[model samples]
Target: MSGPLRLIELRPSPNNIKVRLGLRLKGCEFETIPVALDDAERAEVLRLSGQPLTPVLLDGDLPVWDSAAILRHLDTIAPHEPIFFGRTRERIHEVERWERWARGVVYDTFTIVPGMAFRGAFDPAEVERANAEMRRHTARIEEALADRDYLLGDAPTAADLTLVPMVFSTMLTEEQAAASRIAAFLRQHFHLGEERDRTRAWVERLMAHWH
Candidate 1:
């Protein structure tokens, strides 16, 4: 009778996972339109959103693209259970700081590994370079998780959800996500727990509806 909240997701992309995690957190149900993300579909998405990126959320006439923007949009619809903020502003800042580090350094470094590993045409030297970059970031994260149960505090936050796709996918081939401190952090804190259920459900739902 009614259309699902249309969410366009690009497969094989951590950016798409970011919004999927966000929507799962909000408990927002949506119809996913799986976009192939090949040259043709990428151009189509670019024409629609003015960029060739993944995880574009379109509700009625409103268009929300980018993982961060989608997350923010969800927050507006459901603010009581805030993902980015907590009881205090400091808490929000802390989450933002870690989230920035995740995407900027950790995810940026570790994100490329799985793609290279899975792609048939990948160069061995490039994969080695990616692994080295990821190892360095993993060590950093392992140190960060030495004491904290999660990235922000005892509870998982926006930062944790955002970081999961990249970290989890990196270890998709049964390898450790990172090295030294950051690797330990991912294994101990990120590998399991509630977020896993949420993310799994999201992917399953997408598969069922988006296809």
Candidate 2:
């Protein structure tokens, strides 16, 4: 094997989850390094990374931060089976569109809207708002998933990989009564496994080993 890709995983991070999922899908091995990003450690992280975020991948001397960037890096390293399944640029753009949607819209509402609207921080009010907002987002997501088994199409795309982590742990611990379809999809495909058979299995395996 080539030298292991070094990964620094920050806590309470869904973006990191997507990067980890990408690595798993590409069959790339990496050293997972847990980092703290919630407080004073954030400055340390920024100094070390020259950025202020998690899911940082250190490949030899090259450092790649951000989930989408990490996914692209992994794809280049192992090109045999691409994490992105589309053969056409249009299809790829479709996946990218949803990736951006999840990043900007869904996660934005679920993660910070609740707090920002009332408490000026991600607090109970934020959690409450997140639930209502997440429900609304989930309705749209459920509609998208109604005909296809996965979010993008019949097979899971980067869109699914991106959203799972953002919504998965939060929905379970913070909001237990999340929309049924989203929760069921995560449980069945990511947590429990049935509608899943590929990268989904890999994700379950990683959570077991990492946490």
Candidate 3:
């Protein structure tokens, strides 16, 4: 909090997107340094975070790795505009629960499936399984949003920021798809469909409001 924040990232990564959204939500002005999967960039990342991972946040001289950890750091630095809504103990736990689910369930599908597709190891059955898993997950999101505009309430919290980008990958616009092969792959394979009406609408609403 004492120095200008710096986010080391791969631009198209959903985890990186979550950190960016968290920073914006907290009204923090920061600089983003985009990195690639190359030897030089990997060494830089390892030096900064002790691991070669994108989305390493330099908070002053403190390097915080992992998207969730970075978001928690944001809340610590900017408590007034918390990523966890209300700043209550209960709300913190609730938001953390959602973050875990997002990382475990939603993030896994987006990462594994896309990694396979991008590697040219694509299998129709694998994609079908991933798509089915997505539908199941989105159905849960739909039910969660049944009585609220956002995941925890009317305002977007870390939970929403964490999940939205991963979900958005599945429903990317033509322009978004054209820009990123990973996005194109996700759009081609994962279909949210009309069944997840509320979840689909919620993703669109958050994209318009936040992005």
Scored by lDDT, the top model is 3
User: What 10-residue stretch in candidate 2 is worst by lDDT?
Assistant: 187-196
lDDT of 1 by residue, 36-133 (tens): 64456586677666776777887765768877777767777667564554557888688788778877887666644444433534465755676666
In the order shown, the candidates' Cα RMSDs to the true structure are 8.2, 7.2, 2.1
TM-score of decoy 3: 0.89
- lDDT measured at residue 147 in model 3 versus the true structure, 0 to 100: 99
> Clashing residue pairs in candidate 1, if any?
138-182, 138-183, 139-182, 141-182, 142-181, 142-182, 143-181
lDDT by residue (65-172, candidate 3, tens digit) is 988788778878887754554477899889889988998878778776788766978888878887888888888899999999889887878889889988888788
| Candidate 2 per-residue lDDT over residues 1-211, each given as its tens digit | 2456888886446777777777776667777877754364566557657886787888886778878877766767776554564667888798899888988998776555333423333355545565667666666665676566667665556787777775554434224324343343333222221332333433343344223
Alpha carbon deviation, residue 130, candidate 2 (Å): 2.4
Off by over 4 Å in 1: 1-4, 39-50, 85-87, 111-125, 146-149, 173-211
lDDT of each: 0.60, 0.62, 0.80
**TM-score of predicted model 1?**
0.68
Candidate 1 lDDT at 130 equals: 64
